[model samples]
Target: MASSSRSTLYENLKLVDTVAKVKTTVKELRRQKEISVDCEGNNLSREGTLDILIIGTVNRKVFLFDITKMGVSAFDAGLRDLLESGCDVMAKLMYDCRNDSDALMHLYDVKLAGVLDLQLVEIDSRRKSKQNHWFLKGLKKSIEVYDHDEKSERTKKNGTEQIEDAKRNGTTIWDKRPLSPDLKDYCAVDTVKLFSLLKVFRKKMEREKMLEASERYVDYFRSYETFPETKFYRHGFLPDEILRSNPRDPKVQYNDCQGCKKKFKRARLDLVNAGEKKRANFCSCCSRIITRIENQPIPSQSFA
Candidate 1:
């Protein structure tokens, strides 16, 4: 039960009048320690994790749990574990993992790590994001699931089990609902199988030197800079980062950023040479910092 596994949140969605996409994804991610997971089905324009959030850990083990309709207690227990431990086990857990720190904190109450990303890995592996966009899908296709033992199979719940039982629960599989005791074992088996799948997939990637690629892809998506939506809600980022009320010039030595059309003192070095220039050189903010970057440059040094 270590390679790959996913458990659906059967009634959770119905309980909360929401969709089950979040739980399904979390189940997929929870199994694989070193892998990539995302939900293309969701509308990316949205800001919530309900939109799509892929999580991973370096411990060679990572668990994804979807709690869209879940209560506060369920989240607090899991969140407190990560926050108090201060481990990298929970790397990416937000819709915009890099910039959505505020969202994560509000939801999960934790600070994330600034480690490597799968995007950089993909670049190193010489793969295009477009072609390799469905990395997990490809992996899923490679894995063929079947029954391990017919005798161990549990009774059907929604009848889809019977329709698909032959293909899924052969003489080898033990698939069933988690609500019942007989099926509870089946549920545990799914969770364990997930762990197994991750182990296998991760090993395969590592053995083939493709781990870097996966990591890079994950990183690239994590670092993606999404624009603010109407909600103005944020996660991970501090109060200073979420709002651009006092945006500044990156190239200027010191001063508030002038509007794009205006001009200001140029680089101090350039000013030192002529002592002054009447041509009116614009500061970096006016020329390109604000207009071009439109972001607080990744600070060269972090106090942390």
Candidate 2:
């Protein structure tokens, strides 16, 4: 579908608040090769409420499932099958699927799969362009950088302002019933533009021959066991696994820090010899701490 038509469809977003609507939406979704998804709630994670789930189709159709109202029935109505691994639906395009995956597994026992996280894709694009930073970008910033269409840009700006306004007013906006016009539009904009952004990044990754590496990064967070005890916690400051798997210089080696147990480039880590074939690696921070401890003055012997 054309981008303009898709935008129009998103503007006329469908609300699926009943079991019948969910079934119909799921049936339609199963026919698509890819779908864009986003979730909204108060602190959305394993322990938080999953109030809204927005799913957008490649054909431009968008459905805002009112998870707050339907609750467990939404899953019983086929939303579970649509989200879990090995479903007929090909890919669930999301910005960062980690927290969403965490919530789905712990709350609904749904292991989300076939995910193409555009956040990771964007990172891969930066790596290809030789951008040195690994900082994660939020959806609004990503839209600003990638989605150049006038309408989408306007939508992005308007939605961001609305969210900021709500924040300023000290409103728990997502928890409110009968979602405000701005809130609904915010949800729609978040899900709908993901399709276009995915298209842009997918093509770039394919041309760069990093499609496989991007896939690996996307799958890295799927395992529930890898999630942290705290809800919505990221595994590390840097995406070490992604850096290791898709290195700008493939010749560069990586090793695990004996102190923190996180991966880092070999050059960034110091080799610490504990004695007699007992050598360990430590990252700069860990190495510094170890040096400080080892250099502490020993107390003088006081025994007579």
Candidate 3:
């Protein structure tokens, strides 16, 4: 039986904080062939820290790990290896995986393999049908049919409210020690639903002959490098033609980073080439400083 505080869906869930537990969990999970994965981060930006990592097998065995609890070095080597490479598992499923993959790379300096984002599959299927619609949907809405538990009633009410509060405050709720039961339920549901959604999405992809496209889509995002947000493109706002028209002009103007006053040439042209126009001029140094601020942990405390 699940603890009364937890939903029945997570009654069998395990929390892995030790190297030994991670090793054993990976061994057992590999036997299941596939897993669904999700993560909670400090922020939505590219540099955000990955604070909570969740994995669930097809059979509903779920594991939650607080990566910060042990610090990165103390984090289970087995799990890190599994995420990076040399894992027997056949596939890892996720939904809209770009942010998660970026956070993982930012935190652990590793990338996930054998990943398939269900969102990509849905998009391909919709395109094939020539139906037009916004593709982003919350996991709860996307996989509501798979949830059969009465506990979800309470979770929907409490979890949604708590998550909204965290967003409103710009607080990292996942950084709170002694994780709250409501937050735990929210995290668990996020991961567990991925497995359920994967099963359904996989079949849909195969039927529509879009399995190949889905794989390619995931690979593209995995290798993608995101540019700075549009708001940061300041001094580099010149039209590409104008910039290129005088590539050899010795008299071309140079701009300094607003924050550091460091000189850079063709800042606007650089932004344009990156598919953005300048709203402000920031040197690479100032941009990294901003990224660090966005990725700061809650409580303003250092973990190690």
Candidate 4:
């Protein structure tokens, strides 16, 4: 039961097309207390388009639901039910679970529960490692080690080349009617890697007695009500947060507006309160502060 052998045996290719197939898949998924789930798509949250949903069970079986071919109805309630039930009792494995969670929420209003995000586990482990050189490892690197470097150079090179080609195509391939083998392989490996990497990570966590901590982090990850905004789409304060905090707090500092390049000292706390609320680096006069800020950076302020 080596990770590499298990991955090779599963092959990551099981297409579920019919309602009966969906029901069967759900039945199988519900029976497992641990499973890995992944999705392939282009700007999933932004475009709300998905190519495939790969669900891998603890037994190394993967169900590849071709979203385009089968349509949302094929997997809709069954898929959501599996995930919803999984959240309560099953350990759902994923890498970067936040994005996947967001995509699921946007596309189908599915809220993923009971997720064990390997990436966060890796991060938590890295943070606790005594070695100074410890760093977060990506899924590919995690899989490479589990594979014991047995992958052929040509396969690795071809994967890299194909990935670059897909990047150049810029979401075009995501919309392609029939998935090419190369793309399918790429998508399949993602879910397969989750399964394989979890074995490696789980063992490490158990050995270090940090498995509980890793599981605890998943609850923390799930608590986020909304995804933090990036800089380009940054808006000042969220209306809800703005209404919750005091605008008159004197602790708020009015520094020169980074966006307006103004020295207007008379503006008072209007801009400072706004900036602090939005977690903006500069005043609201400038571009919407281009990053999400957790309240810990500021003193005595709670993230509203």
Candidate 5:
């Protein structure tokens, strides 16, 4: 049986001291094992200040539960738990870990090891450059705890109407405690949905040869040089023309990654192939680069 425990945290923005409980929670989670972790950080300030809120799992349904008594300290414990868990726990994300590392450093103070950063998992996971959305986390449909395809359309409609209101009155997620319930709902769903997608993707991967091929291409982008979020269009790897692809169809015309030095098709993992294959890049290995490199580029391309 999976032990699904939960805790909630009510942040008292008035006192950073109130965040002490977050520290305690980190220690506790470290002792645990095999978890799913996700964080929502509001870029609330012009200085890029963020409110890093996380929803973690032990073994339970990916439903958003309240655990306020545990306090925000639970997040700290989560970071510790994930970091110390070593090779056993693999935390996945839909965005570049580098963008979030600043806020993350506050939780995990040291360089982490024994963790499978899906970012560094493989090269295909990386796109050729900034032009590649293949590296963008959470673009594919791994699974969903709740069917938000309906809600997604709703969010779009609401966002369109809110655009005018947003312009008139800027929003701040920090002072908007008890952390806007709307934000909370969005955050929790994204995390749970990621888990749902993972469960389905893993099963699908085991059954389909083609889907596994896609994952290998996706894995290539997960390396030190590639920004896991947007591997294609590395800072200076490719030409300006290739840097510009049809956002509507990036896979068909994306840039060559500095790492792989080849074309990467990103749209393979778009909405069209959700149930059929794990949305990601396709094969583009340069045999010469494959042979010349000391350390291989994100070569997690698995073809069996």
Candidate 6:
């Protein structure tokens, strides 16, 4: 249940469990310039459950579509069109869109388009300062850091505690029937605060002249294709383009790769165990070659 500070927030929270509701919600969403999007589920990925999709509007209303109940029909009822339209009119503001995009495309055949990922925006905002800019920031931390309003802070704190409690007790909270009030608030707060964070980061990006770079960073994950064979959904997996965009600190020294014996930036090198009591660094290309070679099938022993 939401606390007194957030009691009024519940008024704007709507649950779209039926197909008709999805149609109405999507229609309303189409008129907005941007919408906050988040997915809650049991391990949201290609093979995992996508139980709820939370969408927040600029007017402070949040619509939680019960994916578990409505199923693919939810997508068929204008949800897919709204998401896949790829128009400039409506942008989806999400934190990290990789896993969500993976699940959407693979599960419901919904290709997510026109996404402005706040995770990338946050990273870009910190690039000039070089304060761990390469690392992705989670939504909770972003709220605490960027959108530190009293209401947002309170909501983030309460939601995080409830979510942790649910996890510790082995609860599939998202799959619960007739979703609990606390769970609804938890989902709602994520999307709601995204609008705030987006405003904060957009201003920072514009001031720092990183708007183009930020868009490029988002485009890295905008591809509809999912590489199931690779570690595409890995949390730490970032594209080379993104790695290259990280602002290099003059204070931080570069490393020489053992494989190519070439000087490379800090973020571009990977450390691997070369042998006993020794470690070696390799660049992305060398690492890929090493991985391919190691993964190659051993030649079958000749029985002749």
Instruction: Evaluate all candidate structures by whole-model CA lDDT and list the values in order.
Output: 0.30, 0.65, 0.57, 0.54, 0.35, 0.67
List the lowest-lDDT window of 10 residues for candidate 6: 295-304
lDDT of 5 by residue, 1-304 (tens): 1112332312111111233444544444455443444444334211243354444443432322122333335335454445434344543333223334433444333223332223222222234333353322332231222234666434434533443465457753432345444444444444444444445344323223322332332233332342322333222222221212323463455644333444544323121222343334433323223323323333344211
Q: In angstroms, give how far residue 267 of model 3 lies from its true place.
A: 23
CA deviation > 4 Å runs, candidate 4: 1-12, 46-48, 86-88, 131-136, 145-160, 204-304
Choose the strongest candidate by lDDT: 6
What TM-score would each prediction reach against the true structure?
0.31, 0.70, 0.65, 0.63, 0.43, 0.72
Q: Candidate 3 clashing pairs?
A: 233-278, 233-279, 233-280, 234-279, 234-280, 234-281, 235-280, 235-281, 236-267, 236-268
Which stretches of model 3 miss by more than 4 angstroms? 1-6, 44-46, 74-76, 85-88, 144-154, 207-226, 230-304
lDDT of 6 by residue, 111-168 (tens): 8877777777777667767776645678778888876667656766776787788889
Ordered from best to worst lDDT, the candidate numbers read 6, 2, 3, 4, 5, 1
Lowest summed-lDDT stretch of 10 residues in model 1?
Answer: 9-18
C-alpha positional error of residue 210 in candidate 6 after TM-score superposition, expressed in Å: 7.5
Give the per-residue lDDT digits (tens) of candidate 4, residues 1-304.
1112134535546667566777777876777878888877666553457667778876667677766666667657488777765444787778755446666766666766667677655655555575422234666665665544444333445656865687787634565755565555556666666766776667566422233333333332234444333431223222111111224446554344333332223232222344554332333323323223422222222122
List candidate 2 stretches off by more than 4 Å: 1-11, 87-89, 161-171, 207-238, 243-304
Worst 10 residues of 2 by lDDT: 295-304
Candidate 1 structure quality by residue, lDDT tens digits, 126-202:
33324442122211222233223232233223322533554454421222212233233222323233333444334
Clashing residue pairs, candidate 4? Answer: 87-113, 231-290, 259-286
Which residue runs does candidate 5 get wrong by more than 4 Å?
Answer: 1-20, 42-47, 58-85, 89-96, 106-171, 204-304
lDDT of candidate model 6 versus the reference:
0.67
Give the alpha carbon lDDT tens digit for every residue of 1-304 in model 3: 2122334776467777666666667777667666778888676334666777888777666787767675574244567666654223466777766567666665676666666666656555565688642233545666665444556656767977877898899776777787777767777776777766666666556532333433343333334454434433222221111111223356866665554443456463122223444455655535544444454212221101
Worst 10 residues of 3 by lDDT: 237-246
* TM-score between candidate 3 and the true structure: 0.65
Candidate 6 residue-wise lDDT at 137: 75
